[model samples]
Target: MLYKLNLEHILFLDIETVPESETFEQLDDVKQELWEHKTQYQRKDEFTAEEFYERAGIWAEFGKIICISVGYFTSKGDVRNFRVTTFHGAEAKLLKEFKNLLNSHFSKPNHLLCAHNGKEFDFPYIARRMVIHGINLPYKLDLFGKKPWEVPHLDTMELWKFGDYKHYTSLKLMANVLGIPSPKEDIDGSMVRDVYYNNGDLDRIIKYCELDVITTAQVFLRLRNEELLSDNEIVRI
Candidate 1:
Protein backbone atom coordinates (compact mmCIF):
# COMPACT_ATOMS: atom_id res chain seq x y z
CA MET A 1 0.00 0.00 0.00
CA LEU A 2 1.19 3.51 -0.70
CA TYR A 3 1.87 5.59 2.37
CA LYS A 4 0.40 9.04 2.83
CA LEU A 5 2.28 12.01 4.20
CA ASN A 6 1.65 12.69 7.85
CA LEU A 7 1.25 16.18 9.26
CA GLU A 8 3.81 15.53 12.00
CA HIS A 9 6.50 14.86 9.40
CA ILE A 10 6.82 18.42 8.11
CA LEU A 11 9.42 20.78 9.56
CA PHE A 12 9.89 24.36 8.43
CA LEU A 13 13.15 26.09 9.29
CA ASP A 14 15.22 29.30 8.72
CA ILE A 15 18.63 30.72 9.67
CA GLU A 16 20.51 34.05 9.94
CA THR A 17 24.23 34.57 9.37
CA VAL A 18 26.74 37.35 10.14
CA PRO A 19 30.51 37.83 9.83
CA GLU A 20 32.93 37.55 12.77
CA SER A 21 33.57 40.80 14.65
CA GLU A 22 36.79 40.37 16.67
CA THR A 23 38.78 39.60 13.55
CA PHE A 24 36.82 42.20 11.62
CA GLU A 25 39.72 44.53 11.03
CA GLN A 26 42.16 41.69 10.55
CA LEU A 27 39.86 40.19 7.95
CA ASP A 28 39.85 43.52 6.11
CA ASP A 29 43.64 43.55 6.11
CA VAL A 30 43.72 40.02 4.69
CA LYS A 31 41.23 41.04 1.99
CA GLN A 32 43.33 44.02 1.01
CA GLU A 33 46.43 41.87 0.84
CA LEU A 34 44.69 39.22 -1.23
CA TRP A 35 43.16 41.77 -3.59
CA GLU A 36 46.66 43.17 -4.10
CA HIS A 37 47.92 39.66 -4.83
CA LYS A 38 45.19 38.78 -7.34
CA THR A 39 45.24 40.77 -10.62
CA GLN A 40 41.97 39.40 -12.03
CA TYR A 41 38.67 40.06 -10.17
CA GLN A 42 40.69 42.81 -8.45
CA ARG A 43 39.67 46.43 -8.28
CA LYS A 44 40.53 49.60 -6.38
CA ASP A 45 37.63 48.98 -3.94
CA GLU A 46 37.66 45.20 -4.20
CA PHE A 47 37.70 43.46 -0.83
CA THR A 48 39.13 40.16 0.34
CA ALA A 49 37.59 37.79 2.87
CA GLU A 50 39.61 39.60 5.52
CA GLU A 51 38.53 43.03 4.36
CA PHE A 52 34.92 41.94 4.07
CA TYR A 53 35.22 40.46 7.53
CA GLU A 54 36.38 43.80 8.84
CA ARG A 55 33.79 45.83 6.98
CA ALA A 56 30.75 43.53 6.74
CA GLY A 57 31.47 41.38 9.83
CA ILE A 58 32.26 37.66 9.60
CA TRP A 59 29.57 35.05 10.29
CA ALA A 60 31.65 33.67 13.14
CA GLU A 61 31.86 37.00 14.95
CA PHE A 62 29.07 38.91 16.81
CA GLY A 63 28.35 36.12 19.33
CA LYS A 64 28.57 33.25 16.78
CA ILE A 65 24.98 32.03 16.49
CA ILE A 66 23.28 34.72 14.49
CA CYS A 67 19.93 32.89 14.75
CA ILE A 68 18.24 29.59 13.89
CA SER A 69 14.48 29.05 14.04
CA VAL A 70 12.15 26.18 13.18
CA GLY A 71 8.40 25.82 12.79
CA TYR A 72 6.29 22.64 13.03
CA PHE A 73 2.80 22.41 11.58
CA THR A 74 0.22 19.65 12.10
CA SER A 75 -2.93 19.82 10.05
CA LYS A 76 -6.20 18.13 11.06
CA GLY A 77 -9.17 19.56 9.11
CA ASP A 78 -10.02 23.30 9.02
CA VAL A 79 -7.41 24.65 11.38
CA ARG A 80 -3.64 24.29 11.18
CA ASN A 81 -1.68 23.91 14.38
CA PHE A 82 1.70 25.59 14.67
CA ARG A 83 4.63 25.48 17.10
CA VAL A 84 7.95 27.32 16.82
CA THR A 85 11.38 26.78 18.36
CA THR A 86 14.33 29.16 18.10
CA PHE A 87 17.98 29.08 19.17
CA HIS A 88 20.63 31.80 19.60
CA GLY A 89 24.14 31.28 20.88
CA ALA A 90 27.72 30.91 19.71
CA GLU A 91 27.76 29.69 16.11
CA ALA A 92 29.45 26.37 16.72
CA LYS A 93 27.61 25.45 19.93
CA LEU A 94 24.17 26.53 18.73
CA LEU A 95 24.57 24.61 15.49
CA LYS A 96 25.73 21.55 17.40
CA GLU A 97 22.80 21.78 19.76
CA PHE A 98 20.44 22.29 16.85
CA LYS A 99 21.77 19.14 15.22
CA ASN A 100 21.48 17.19 18.45
CA LEU A 101 17.91 18.33 18.93
CA LEU A 102 17.04 17.26 15.42
CA ASN A 103 18.60 13.86 15.97
CA SER A 104 17.04 13.23 19.37
CA HIS A 105 13.64 14.86 19.03
CA PHE A 106 12.72 14.57 15.37
CA SER A 107 14.86 11.76 14.00
CA LYS A 108 12.08 9.77 12.44
CA PRO A 109 14.01 9.65 9.18
CA ASN A 110 10.78 10.26 7.35
CA HIS A 111 10.17 13.89 8.19
CA LEU A 112 10.06 16.44 5.38
CA LEU A 113 12.15 19.56 5.87
CA CYS A 114 10.67 22.66 4.33
CA ALA A 115 11.94 26.17 3.79
CA HIS A 116 11.73 28.96 1.25
CA ASN A 117 14.83 28.93 -0.97
CA GLY A 118 16.12 26.34 1.47
CA LYS A 119 17.78 24.16 -1.18
CA GLU A 120 19.90 27.12 -2.21
CA PHE A 121 20.73 28.70 1.13
CA ASP A 122 19.36 27.64 4.51
CA PHE A 123 19.84 23.88 4.20
CA PRO A 124 23.29 24.02 2.64
CA TYR A 125 24.44 26.69 5.05
CA ILE A 126 23.42 24.53 8.01
CA ALA A 127 25.04 21.42 6.57
CA ARG A 128 28.32 23.16 5.77
CA ARG A 129 28.52 24.81 9.18
CA MET A 130 27.70 21.55 10.93
CA VAL A 131 30.52 19.81 9.08
CA ILE A 132 32.85 22.65 10.01
CA HIS A 133 31.92 22.15 13.65
CA GLY A 134 32.61 18.39 13.38
CA ILE A 135 28.94 17.46 13.58
CA ASN A 136 27.28 15.03 11.18
CA LEU A 137 24.34 16.28 9.19
CA PRO A 138 21.17 14.44 10.27
CA TYR A 139 19.76 14.03 6.77
CA LYS A 140 20.59 14.23 3.09
CA LEU A 141 20.37 17.77 1.70
CA ASP A 142 21.85 17.29 -1.75
CA LEU A 143 18.89 18.31 -3.88
CA PHE A 144 21.06 18.59 -6.96
CA GLY A 145 21.67 14.85 -6.79
CA LYS A 146 17.97 14.03 -7.13
CA LYS A 147 15.80 14.07 -10.20
CA PRO A 148 14.28 17.51 -10.73
CA TRP A 149 10.78 16.39 -9.67
CA GLU A 150 11.77 13.50 -7.43
CA VAL A 151 13.42 15.51 -4.73
CA PRO A 152 11.33 15.51 -1.56
CA HIS A 153 11.44 19.29 -1.35
CA LEU A 154 9.24 22.29 -1.75
CA ASP A 155 10.30 25.86 -2.40
CA THR A 156 7.52 28.46 -2.41
CA MET A 157 9.44 30.33 -5.06
CA GLU A 158 9.30 27.21 -7.22
CA LEU A 159 5.54 26.97 -6.76
CA TRP A 160 5.12 30.45 -8.18
CA LYS A 161 6.36 29.03 -11.46
CA PHE A 162 2.77 27.95 -12.14
CA GLY A 163 2.11 31.61 -12.72
CA ASP A 164 4.91 31.73 -15.28
CA TYR A 165 7.59 32.85 -12.74
CA LYS A 166 6.36 36.28 -13.72
CA HIS A 167 8.15 38.58 -11.31
CA TYR A 168 10.61 37.41 -8.71
CA THR A 169 8.85 37.20 -5.35
CA SER A 170 10.05 36.93 -1.77
CA LEU A 171 8.44 35.16 1.19
CA LYS A 172 7.27 38.53 2.52
CA LEU A 173 5.80 39.47 -0.87
CA MET A 174 4.11 36.10 -1.26
CA ALA A 175 2.59 36.32 2.21
CA ASN A 176 1.23 39.77 1.37
CA VAL A 177 -0.22 38.59 -1.94
CA LEU A 178 -1.88 35.62 -0.23
CA GLY A 179 -3.35 37.78 2.55
CA ILE A 180 -1.17 36.06 5.12
CA PRO A 181 -0.07 38.37 7.94
CA SER A 182 3.71 38.47 7.95
CA PRO A 183 5.31 38.81 11.38
CA LYS A 184 8.59 40.10 9.92
CA GLU A 185 7.58 43.76 10.37
CA ASP A 186 10.59 46.11 10.30
CA ILE A 187 13.21 43.38 10.82
CA ASP A 188 14.51 41.63 7.72
CA GLY A 189 17.37 39.32 6.71
CA SER A 190 19.53 42.28 5.58
CA MET A 191 19.28 43.94 8.99
CA VAL A 192 20.09 40.76 10.92
CA ARG A 193 23.88 41.28 11.13
CA ASP A 194 23.56 44.86 12.31
CA VAL A 195 20.80 44.11 14.81
CA TYR A 196 22.92 41.46 16.46
CA TYR A 197 26.17 43.40 16.22
CA ASN A 198 25.15 46.96 17.11
CA ASN A 199 22.36 46.35 19.62
CA GLY A 200 23.56 42.97 20.95
CA ASP A 201 19.94 41.96 21.26
CA LEU A 202 19.69 38.18 20.95
CA ASP A 203 15.95 38.29 21.67
CA ARG A 204 15.26 40.39 18.59
CA ILE A 205 17.28 37.99 16.52
CA ILE A 206 15.32 35.04 17.88
CA LYS A 207 12.06 36.84 17.18
CA TYR A 208 13.25 37.65 13.69
CA CYS A 209 14.09 34.01 13.03
CA GLU A 210 10.70 32.95 14.39
CA LEU A 211 8.99 35.38 12.04
CA ASP A 212 10.72 33.86 9.03
CA VAL A 213 9.70 30.35 10.02
CA ILE A 214 6.13 31.45 10.55
CA THR A 215 6.10 33.21 7.22
CA THR A 216 7.45 30.08 5.58
CA ALA A 217 4.70 28.01 7.18
CA GLN A 218 2.10 30.48 5.93
CA VAL A 219 3.48 30.18 2.44
CA PHE A 220 3.30 26.40 2.68
CA LEU A 221 -0.35 26.64 3.67
CA ARG A 222 -1.16 28.91 0.77
CA LEU A 223 0.39 26.48 -1.68
CA ARG A 224 -1.27 23.44 -0.13
CA ASN A 225 -4.70 25.01 -0.21
CA GLU A 226 -4.40 26.15 -3.79
CA GLU A 227 -2.86 23.05 -5.29
CA LEU A 228 -2.42 20.15 -2.88
CA LEU A 229 -5.51 20.26 -0.71
CA SER A 230 -8.56 18.40 -1.93
CA ASP A 231 -10.90 20.69 -0.04
CA ASN A 232 -10.82 24.20 1.44
CA GLU A 233 -9.97 23.02 4.93
CA ILE A 234 -7.03 23.12 7.27
CA VAL A 235 -6.45 20.26 9.68
CA ARG A 236 -5.27 21.27 13.11
CA ILE A 237 -2.28 19.42 14.47
Candidate 2:
Protein backbone atom coordinates (compact mmCIF):
# COMPACT_ATOMS: atom_id res chain seq x y z
CA MET A 1 0.00 0.00 0.00
CA LEU A 2 1.05 3.60 -0.36
CA TYR A 3 1.75 3.74 3.38
CA LYS A 4 3.58 0.45 3.52
CA LEU A 5 7.01 1.52 2.40
CA ASN A 6 9.10 -0.66 4.71
CA LEU A 7 6.22 -0.63 7.20
CA GLU A 8 8.33 -1.49 10.21
CA HIS A 9 10.65 1.38 9.37
CA ILE A 10 9.08 4.74 8.72
CA LEU A 11 9.12 7.82 10.90
CA PHE A 12 7.91 11.25 9.86
CA LEU A 13 9.12 14.11 11.98
CA ASP A 14 9.07 17.94 12.14
CA ILE A 15 10.33 20.68 14.41
CA GLU A 16 9.23 24.19 15.47
CA THR A 17 11.90 26.77 16.18
CA VAL A 18 11.93 30.14 17.97
CA PRO A 19 14.32 32.86 18.88
CA GLU A 20 16.19 32.19 22.16
CA SER A 21 15.85 34.70 24.92
CA GLU A 22 15.77 33.91 28.62
CA THR A 23 15.19 37.43 29.85
CA PHE A 24 14.66 41.00 28.80
CA GLU A 25 18.36 41.90 29.09
CA GLN A 26 19.41 38.90 27.05
CA LEU A 27 16.82 39.79 24.43
CA ASP A 28 18.27 43.27 24.20
CA ASP A 29 21.76 41.93 23.59
CA VAL A 30 20.43 39.54 20.98
CA LYS A 31 18.46 42.32 19.28
CA GLN A 32 21.50 44.58 19.20
CA GLU A 33 23.66 41.82 17.79
CA LEU A 34 21.02 41.01 15.22
CA TRP A 35 20.67 44.66 14.20
CA GLU A 36 24.42 45.08 13.71
CA HIS A 37 24.54 41.85 11.75
CA LYS A 38 21.78 43.07 9.43
CA THR A 39 23.53 46.39 8.90
CA GLN A 40 26.72 44.61 7.95
CA TYR A 41 24.88 42.37 5.48
CA GLN A 42 23.19 45.36 3.83
CA ARG A 43 26.49 47.28 3.63
CA LYS A 44 28.58 44.20 2.80
CA ASP A 45 30.59 44.95 5.91
CA GLU A 46 32.71 42.47 7.91
CA PHE A 47 30.74 39.41 8.97
CA THR A 48 30.33 38.27 12.56
CA ALA A 49 27.71 36.56 14.77
CA GLU A 50 25.97 39.90 15.07
CA GLU A 51 25.85 40.36 11.31
CA PHE A 52 25.25 36.70 10.66
CA TYR A 53 22.04 36.60 12.72
CA GLU A 54 20.75 39.70 10.99
CA ARG A 55 21.21 38.24 7.52
CA ALA A 56 20.32 34.65 8.27
CA GLY A 57 16.57 35.34 7.92
CA ILE A 58 14.51 32.92 9.98
CA TRP A 59 17.60 31.33 11.48
CA ALA A 60 18.35 34.39 13.60
CA GLU A 61 18.44 34.13 17.44
CA PHE A 62 19.96 30.67 17.14
CA GLY A 63 16.55 29.02 16.41
CA LYS A 64 15.67 27.53 19.75
CA ILE A 65 13.36 24.64 19.02
CA ILE A 66 10.39 24.30 21.36
CA CYS A 67 8.67 21.33 19.83
CA ILE A 68 9.54 18.11 18.05
CA SER A 69 6.64 16.12 16.56
CA VAL A 70 6.81 12.66 15.03
CA GLY A 71 4.31 10.61 13.10
CA TYR A 72 4.54 6.85 12.48
CA PHE A 73 2.77 5.20 9.54
CA THR A 74 2.27 1.58 8.60
CA SER A 75 0.01 -0.23 6.20
CA LYS A 76 -3.34 -1.50 7.36
CA GLY A 77 -6.12 -3.04 5.30
CA ASP A 78 -7.20 -0.31 2.94
CA VAL A 79 -6.21 2.76 4.88
CA ARG A 80 -3.11 4.58 6.09
CA ASN A 81 -3.60 6.45 9.34
CA PHE A 82 -0.46 7.52 11.18
CA ARG A 83 0.07 7.76 14.94
CA VAL A 84 1.48 11.08 16.03
CA THR A 85 3.72 11.86 19.04
CA THR A 86 5.07 15.15 20.26
CA PHE A 87 7.78 16.38 22.62
CA HIS A 88 7.77 19.89 24.03
CA GLY A 89 9.93 21.69 26.58
CA ALA A 90 12.90 23.98 26.91
CA GLU A 91 15.42 23.75 24.09
CA ALA A 92 17.93 21.58 25.96
CA LYS A 93 15.28 19.45 27.59
CA LEU A 94 13.42 18.92 24.36
CA LEU A 95 16.63 17.92 22.60
CA LYS A 96 17.38 15.44 25.37
CA GLU A 97 13.90 14.00 25.23
CA PHE A 98 13.94 13.73 21.47
CA LYS A 99 17.24 11.87 21.49
CA ASN A 100 16.00 9.58 24.22
CA LEU A 101 12.80 8.88 22.31
CA LEU A 102 14.76 8.09 19.17
CA ASN A 103 17.07 5.75 21.03
CA SER A 104 14.23 3.98 22.76
CA HIS A 105 11.98 3.64 19.75
CA PHE A 106 14.57 3.17 17.00
CA SER A 107 17.17 1.05 18.74
CA LYS A 108 17.47 -1.05 15.64
CA PRO A 109 19.32 0.19 12.57
CA ASN A 110 16.62 -0.53 10.02
CA HIS A 111 14.01 2.06 10.99
CA LEU A 112 13.92 4.93 8.47
CA LEU A 113 13.71 8.57 9.57
CA CYS A 114 11.76 10.80 7.24
CA ALA A 115 11.19 14.55 7.08
CA HIS A 116 10.38 17.16 4.48
CA ASN A 117 13.46 19.38 4.71
CA GLY A 118 15.09 17.08 7.22
CA LYS A 119 18.34 16.82 5.32
CA GLU A 120 18.84 20.56 5.40
CA PHE A 121 17.23 21.48 8.72
CA ASP A 122 15.47 18.98 10.97
CA PHE A 123 18.03 16.16 10.86
CA PRO A 124 21.12 18.33 11.19
CA TYR A 125 19.55 20.44 13.91
CA ILE A 126 18.65 17.36 15.93
CA ALA A 127 22.10 15.86 15.46
CA ARG A 128 23.95 19.01 16.50
CA ARG A 129 21.76 19.52 19.55
CA MET A 130 22.03 15.87 20.57
CA VAL A 131 25.79 16.22 20.55
CA ILE A 132 25.50 19.42 22.54
CA HIS A 133 23.55 17.54 25.19
CA GLY A 134 26.18 14.78 25.25
CA ILE A 135 23.74 12.33 23.74
CA ASN A 136 24.62 9.94 20.94
CA LEU A 137 22.29 9.86 17.95
CA PRO A 138 20.54 6.67 17.00
CA TYR A 139 22.23 4.61 14.30
CA LYS A 140 19.30 5.23 11.97
CA LEU A 141 20.40 8.85 11.85
CA ASP A 142 23.86 8.02 10.52
CA LEU A 143 23.24 9.69 7.17
CA PHE A 144 26.41 11.75 7.11
CA GLY A 145 28.26 10.13 4.22
CA LYS A 146 25.36 9.04 2.08
CA LYS A 147 24.47 10.80 -1.14
CA PRO A 148 21.36 12.99 -1.06
CA TRP A 149 19.27 10.76 -3.28
CA GLU A 150 20.79 7.54 -1.95
CA VAL A 151 19.99 8.28 1.67
CA PRO A 152 16.99 6.62 3.27
CA HIS A 153 15.49 10.04 3.75
CA LEU A 154 12.35 10.98 1.79
CA ASP A 155 12.14 14.73 1.59
CA THR A 156 8.69 15.76 0.29
CA MET A 157 10.01 19.12 -0.85
CA GLU A 158 12.62 17.43 -2.99
CA LEU A 159 10.04 15.08 -4.47
CA TRP A 160 7.74 18.01 -5.28
CA LYS A 161 10.38 19.42 -7.57
CA PHE A 162 9.57 16.53 -9.93
CA GLY A 163 12.85 17.27 -11.74
CA ASP A 164 12.00 20.89 -12.45
CA TYR A 165 14.25 22.55 -9.82
CA LYS A 166 12.80 25.92 -10.67
CA HIS A 167 11.94 27.17 -7.19
CA TYR A 168 11.80 25.83 -3.65
CA THR A 169 8.23 25.53 -2.42
CA SER A 170 7.22 25.49 1.23
CA LEU A 171 5.15 22.70 2.73
CA LYS A 172 2.17 24.99 3.20
CA LEU A 173 2.36 26.27 -0.36
CA MET A 174 2.72 22.77 -1.70
CA ALA A 175 -0.32 21.68 0.25
CA ASN A 176 -2.26 24.58 -1.20
CA VAL A 177 -1.17 23.79 -4.76
CA LEU A 178 -2.01 20.12 -4.35
CA GLY A 179 -5.46 20.91 -2.97
CA ILE A 180 -4.58 19.43 0.42
CA PRO A 181 -5.91 21.32 3.41
CA SER A 182 -2.96 22.18 5.62
CA PRO A 183 -3.63 22.27 9.36
CA LYS A 184 -0.81 24.81 9.55
CA GLU A 185 -2.37 27.48 7.38
CA ASP A 186 -3.26 29.59 10.42
CA ILE A 187 0.25 29.40 11.90
CA ASP A 188 2.92 30.15 9.34
CA GLY A 189 6.64 29.63 9.87
CA SER A 190 7.32 33.33 10.21
CA MET A 191 5.12 33.46 13.32
CA VAL A 192 6.59 30.33 14.88
CA ARG A 193 9.65 32.01 16.40
CA ASP A 194 7.62 34.87 17.75
CA VAL A 195 4.84 32.72 19.17
CA TYR A 196 7.25 30.56 21.07
CA TYR A 197 9.42 33.41 22.26
CA ASN A 198 6.72 35.88 23.26
CA ASN A 199 3.80 33.72 24.20
CA GLY A 200 5.65 30.81 25.77
CA ASP A 201 3.03 28.60 24.23
CA LEU A 202 4.51 25.18 23.74
CA ASP A 203 1.17 23.73 22.65
CA ARG A 204 1.05 26.08 19.68
CA ILE A 205 4.51 24.98 18.65
CA ILE A 206 3.59 21.32 18.98
CA LYS A 207 0.46 21.82 16.92
CA TYR A 208 2.51 23.58 14.27
CA CYS A 209 5.02 20.77 14.21
CA GLU A 210 2.28 18.15 13.94
CA LEU A 211 0.76 20.01 11.00
CA ASP A 212 4.04 19.88 9.16
CA VAL A 213 4.32 16.18 9.81
CA ILE A 214 0.80 15.61 8.54
CA THR A 215 1.48 17.62 5.39
CA THR A 216 4.70 15.76 4.81
CA ALA A 217 2.97 12.44 5.27
CA GLN A 218 0.22 13.42 2.86
CA VAL A 219 2.84 14.34 0.27
CA PHE A 220 4.60 11.05 0.89
CA LEU A 221 1.40 9.14 0.34
CA ARG A 222 0.84 10.96 -2.91
CA LEU A 223 4.36 10.19 -4.08
CA ARG A 224 4.20 6.57 -3.07
CA ASN A 225 0.98 6.03 -4.95
CA GLU A 226 2.40 7.72 -8.05
CA GLU A 227 5.79 6.01 -8.17
CA LEU A 228 5.93 3.02 -5.80
CA LEU A 229 2.65 1.37 -4.91
CA SER A 230 -1.12 1.61 -4.92
CA ASP A 231 -3.33 2.67 -1.98
CA ASN A 232 -5.65 -0.32 -1.60
CA GLU A 233 -3.01 -2.90 -0.61
CA ILE A 234 -1.90 -3.63 2.94
CA VAL A 235 1.47 -4.19 4.65
CA ARG A 236 2.27 -4.78 8.29
CA ILE A 237 3.59 -1.89 10.34
Query: Judged by lDDT, which candidate is best?
Result: 2
Local lDDT at 220 for model 1: 76
Clashing pairs in 2: 37-50, 37-51
Q: Mark the regions of model 2 whose C-alpha exceeds 4 Å error after superposition.
A: 1-4, 22-61, 75-79, 107-109, 145-150, 164-166, 226-237
Q: lDDT by residue for model 2 over 138-235, one digit each (tens)? A: 66566667676546666778777778766688877776777665562567677775566568676776777786777787777666653322233322
The clash tally of candidate 2 reads 2
TM-score of each: 0.73, 0.74
Report the alpha-carbon TM-score of model 1 versus the true structure: 0.73
